[model samples]
Target: MRREAVLKQSGCRHYRSQPTHGIGRYKHLLPPEPDPKKKDKLPRKEIKPSSDHEYGVLNLQVSGYNMILVEHYSQYVHNLCSRLSIKVQECYAKPTKTKEVMLMQEHSTKMFLDAMLTTHERVVQVTGLSSTMAPILMEVLMMNQPEGVQLLVKEHTEADYQVRFKGRPELENLVASMS
Candidate 1:
């Protein structure tokens, strides 16, 4: 006897036979369809801050023991900001810093130079950024940051700018006396 005829003759009202092939077998696992009435409601718009409100300047400093990685990461940041329409005021490299590692000789009080490490630094200056975009930009940059590269984001200040120059006590004294 056929399956349908046997099911009908058996008087099983609650047991419905489902298709045994393809997606029909998994119909029960699928999610229910959404209500058409709910689709008419529009999505709420996000409110943005006023244009006159200033978000100030930000400095992104990337440093690493490897010069190539540091430069490449800095360039990546610059390109990302440009794509996001954020203003990049300047991009520059700071003077490279070097440190000497010394090791103590075996059973002796004398020390010898073991290795030298040089740290390279690059800065990307951004201006006219919105408050809402700052965190998002930082998160994206940090997520893609390379290994051994340190990223620092801080407000730009006059003291930070002055740090790039060598301090001259005589010039400062002269300016102070004139004032």
Candidate 2:
């Protein structure tokens, strides 16, 4: 009550308004208030604590000369992981070929990779060596990579997290569908 009087007289237009705009005369009707008494009293949200037990896979990113080659290598890795009873996330199941035109796919993929690293996610990218192209691509990629990346490495177990991709429309939509 006293605060309102101070605000009204102090010429503070923010907390109190002058007779202007559509509410010129009816300013009293629209009280300048985030009124405590009139507050909706929304129920406090109770956040359920996540269980200590968690399951996740070791993400093995397989890239090669091409998507086909990468998929082949990925399959081999998958089989090996299965044999070793290792939890593998299989995020690389369907390889999006470079030939298939995807909208800003390179940028999106880069963003995804950056997010993965930022979150301290355990990711070991394995590039298949079909030919010299792998080396060239590696060199190009290495150019941007920071020196002493070993320091960035963080360890995790299968119990740490789960991996899934909420498909991006840019990458998901077909070239024909886009138009």
Candidate 3:
């Protein structure tokens, strides 16, 4: 009672302590960060990539059905290979009504498609694949798709490069005018 009277007379209020609610109260939960300082005066050793540490991409084409469905299916296949400890990278087509491979920009697009087959790379070498693992990859891809969705898979190779690079010659004039 006396404490209450003294508080009232002094115009001071008692507040109950709380753990935290908003960011302000919770700031102290983490240790205060160390202030930035100068770097250590020692040079670090560098490790080079050996043949065993290298990787390569498996070029595939997913088409003959809904573009959206095919892209998802391709991603599904790539993901399945990764889970099985198989090294795989993906190249997918965007949603287009006519099942055409639309080019966003040649320079960037080629890196994911046309260039994969041509480049003689240490980390991304190209390899020809037969039915050893292809059937399993396709079956896994189909299981993930809807019953109505149909997909076609084929190995993209140098044979298809000219066809894509040539593009729609007739539309060339129209495309150039827009740019």
The candidate scoring highest on lDDT is: 1
Tens digit per residue, CA lDDT, model 1, 89-173: 8888887889999999789999999999999999998888887788889899989998999999887776767565556899999
For model 1 the TM-score comes to 0.62
Model 2 TM-score, 2 decimals: 0.25
Q: Residue by residue across 60-125, what tens digits does model 3's lDDT show?
A: 545434445555655665666667555543342432333223346645645222221111101111
Full-model lDDT for every candidate: 0.82, 0.39, 0.46
* Inter-residue clash pairs, candidate 2: none
108 in model 1: Cα distance from truth in Å?
1.5
Q: For residue 48, what is the lDDT in candidate 1?
A: 26
lDDT tens per residue, model 2, 1-179: 99879877967554235445444456667868786777574343222222234322223444433444444544554565455444443333322333322244544553222221111112342222223333453454345433323112122333322232234667667765877
Root-mean-square deviation (CA) per prediction? 22.2, 22.3, 16.2
lDDT of model 1, residue 64: 98
Give lDDT: candidate 2, residue 10.
Answer: 63
Q: Which runs of model 1 end up more than 4 angstroms from their true locations? A: 1-54, 166-179
**lDDT minimum window of 10 residues, candidate 1:** 41-50
